[model samples]
Target: MRCAVANTTVMVRKYERMSGRQSWSEEEMAKAVAAVVSGKMGYKLAARTYHIPRSTLQRRASKVRYQQPDDPKPLMGHYRRVFTESQEKDLVGYIKSMEKFFMGVSRRDIRELAFQYAEDNNLNHPFDVNTRMAGEDWVRNFLKRNPELLHKSEKDYELEPVNFDQFYHFMCQSS
Candidate 1:
């Protein structure tokens, strides 16, 4: 019983130390995998040498000799999201196009768009019918999902290329 308690205490202390700490980086993990792959050391020894988790070493090693599929796991886009994957992409594009035109879209604009988009597409979601708008939670989730739209500097954004010749022709026609 005393030995069990001591082991538990040690585990608790280890957890406390490991919490919110980056003990090993990607380079170190790669080197550890390399050492194991080249028969220089076993997983247990490599993990100890690199200070990385043994399970992490195993996972990386398994992926090293195999090609991982390009299948991207969706981030909460399937369940509980206001828009489907393609729909969200369209909305993101709309938001980005507005940014390109130097027009700022507000939170209210997103909510209204959500309501309008659903109505137009006949999408059945539990949005507020009385206000003719989407729920605040939906809007918040939308922002979180599309983080690139949040706090992105205007200068960092690439505006659509302008055609000067067409503009000059239009201006000449008007004069």
Candidate 2:
């Protein structure tokens, strides 16, 4: 009978299935290997021509040794710290000591002053001049420790009345 589904007029023949012998010739295998090794055709193209998977071709190709170019060296540079602990402490102390003279001075002013002090004293501190500003922690700690330094006047605040108990309480509560 003819098969109508595939539009074929050939007669259908049925029989027990049998395994076929390998038909791949040595010449064809050799040609495929040569084409892949040539480097002119990519392994993918070679695989397509040889009716083999690209990965299989790649594995075969990988067995061959190919020299790769050396990688470029990375750029070298130094990273200097902005401030040391000792420098930070000195800066904090300087600001606290000069608070009466520079009461209305902002953090920026304090930092500039610290920079000037460093420059004047020829202090070989590793702090970047841009980041030497005293923060609120420094001010709070300084005030807490030296409570007698907290003196309020109608004109300006002065470091006079050293209140130890009040300072201790303030520090404890804050902590």
Candidate 3:
């Protein structure tokens, strides 16, 4: 009997901390900036002590010293929202109003609505023009950020077909 083995090649990218994960915690970054700002420690020394990048430490320190941050501790990757606060609020309100009318909007409708709103208002958005809809990931995150909109059940989204089926059944039974 004979056995054979196959070899496969894997691709890897060069690291400039390319893993996309932050090595230091929010508290550590804050302290590093604070130490550098207060003249307690130099940027290089503070970064080394805090196990953070020197350039990041300097940039954060400059921002902290010069400007007011909207959020105290933002996401590590600096994930920014596509829509402004008011726009998101308007979307939530629209969804609520539609639900009150017994016409709950589906996920796809919300995405298309977002695309249309962004286009109509001439606002910059990252949604794909060809698809004419926001990505599913965006809708998922949007719902996640708005806790009140979440269903009482654990399901994050409602199936429109299933809902219609239930409604149809009720109507048929009444007739």
Candidate 4:
């Protein structure tokens, strides 16, 4: 029989013609076992030479069973919220009121108020408290939601500056 190795064929017939009932000779078994025991050759290479699967060779080589490492833990943090239509309207109203009370409030304050009102009424709003940018954002959103407020300051006489006598007369008339 011929055995092929690296494109070279060597003639050897001692272990090539074994029948189905035939078992490995002591010499062949010893050489194969010694090669596996040496640990220098990888199990896949050894198993290929001996005509067995790498997994079976590995199982026969060691007694302990193999197990995969545990999966990593999920990230730690809060989830975002999904507001209903009514809840969204309420939030818009609250933000508008806040804008009317304090012009040019920071976005951080608006975001905090969103979260606070949500929490107070057992709702969920998922804005981060520590990182909101306020400056122009607060005014932009407030105006977008309450566009009438912009006209109030621009066209309404109530927002105009009045003399003390006129203011006194208006106050007295109202009282």
Query: Number of the top candidate by TM-score?
Result: 3
Better of 2 and 4 by lDDT: 2
Model 3 lDDT tens row, 126-171: 8999989989999889888887777644233353322433433343
Higher lDDT: candidate 1 or 2?
A: 1
Candidate with more favorable, higher lDDT: 3 or 4: 3
Q: What ordering of candidates by TM-score runs from best to worst?
A: 3, 1, 4, 2
* TM-score of each prediction: 0.41, 0.25, 0.45, 0.28
Query: What ranking of all candidate models by lDDT puts the best one first?
Result: 3, 1, 2, 4
Write model 1 residue lDDT over 86-154, tens digit each, in one string. 778877776665556544556665676678677766876789899888888888888888997787543
lDDT of each: 0.69, 0.51, 0.72, 0.48
lDDT of 1 at 51: 94
Query: Judged by lDDT, which candidate is best?
Result: 3
What is residue 147's positional error in candidate 1, in angstroms? 0.3
Provide the clashing-pair count of each candidate structure: 0, 3, 0, 1
Candidate 3 stretches with Cα past 4 Å from truth are 1-78, 152-175
Among all windows of ten consecutive residues in candidate 3, which has the lowest summed lDDT?
Answer: 160-169
lDDT of 4: 0.48
Error (Å) of candidate 2 at residue 86 is 1.4
